[model samples]
Target: MSELFENYLACWNETDPTARRALIERHWSEDATYVDPLADVRGHEALDATIGAVQAQFPGFVFTPAGPVDAHHRQARFTWGLGPAGAEPLIVGFDVVVTGTDGRIETVLGFLDRGPG
Candidate 1:
């Protein structure tokens, strides 16, 4: 669960579109969906595009796990922070992930705790 959530943050920081897509392929189930305040997306292509857009918008920022993850019954939640490496976060959010029966991510529900100016 920890590794998977870390990959979620990695997806946020990955600047290479191909690499990010690969990450999505590796970690997400085919029927996966992601939703937050700003957007709702489904499938690998949409998830990849969403991650790419975020990287483009926050050029130098890296997303990192902000706290310990809690998981049970195929569901897990964790907080993440976004900023330059080693610096204070300008953005923060919590995400709840639901793993499929096969243990791949089936859904991600994100809640923004903070956002950059």
Candidate 2:
């Protein structure tokens, strides 16, 4: 479960499109959907583009796990923090993910716990 979150954050932190795409392919299902307060997207392409947009918006920010992940029955929820390295997080979020039988992410429902507003 921690590995899943680690890979998910790695996808967000990776600037190279090729590396990020590989992470997405390995961690997420082909038809995965992600919905948050600000964006809703489906499939690998949209997910990749959305992640790139976030990286562009906050050039040096990195996403990291903020708390322990709790998972059961192919579903998991975790908290995350986003900010410059070694600084307090500027954004905090919670996400619930559902995994397919094959153990890849199938859907992600996200919420903003805190933001830069």
Candidate 3:
């Protein structure tokens, strides 16, 4: 796994909004695309908005990794906290992010898995 992949996951696990936004800004390109259940966003502003919406909706949400990261493809599967700790995490999705040559994410395809939980 590349350092970026690990760092990206670490950033995803971050709860602080400011820190999380900073991480996204640092790792993703200005023209990055974020595809989630809510919407497909292009550019930093949209990305910020998507994160903001999720933050607003989830409240105490936190993403917990559920499987091995496929760093070669810049992909990962993770479960997320819908409310607080100890509650069953919702298996949000497997995210496949493609990075540009500059090591910034160019696009992300999020596939939601609602199975079993």
Candidate 4:
């Protein structure tokens, strides 16, 4: 489960479109959906684009796990922090992920725990 969350954060950190898309394809279901306070999107293309947008908006920042992942029965929850290397996080979030029967992410429900005003 931790590896899954690590891959999830890696997807957010990857800037190369090809690499990111590959990560998404390997870890996420084709019809996966993601919803958060600011965005709601479904499918691989939209997910890729959304991640790209975040990368563009916060260039050089990286996403890291804030704590251990807790998972049970194909569901997992974790917290994440985003910021420049060696600096305190500027944005923090929590996400709950549901994996499909194939063990790929089927859906993600996200919440912003801390963000710029």
Most accurate candidate by lDDT? 4
What tens digits encode model 3's per-residue C-alpha lDDT throughout 34-86? 88775888987777677777667777666655566666554443333333556
Clashes of each: 0, 0, 0, 0
Give each model's whole-structure lDDT.
0.89, 0.93, 0.68, 0.94
TM-score for model 1?
A: 0.95
lDDT of 2 by residue, 29-107 (tens): 9999999998999999999999999999999999989999999899999999999998999999999999999989999
Candidate 3 TM-score, true structure as reference: 0.76
Clashing pairs in 4: none
Residue pairs with backbone atoms closer than 3 Å in model 3 (clashes): none
**Could you tell me how far off, in angstroms, the CA of residue 14 lies in candidate 4 after the best superposition?**
0.5
Residue by residue across 25-114, what tens digits does model 1's lDDT show?
888998799999997999999988888888788888898889999999899999999898899999999999999888889999999999
Candidate 3 wrong stretches, greater than 4 Å: 10-17, 73-83, 115-117
Give the residue spans of candidate 2 off by over 4 A: none
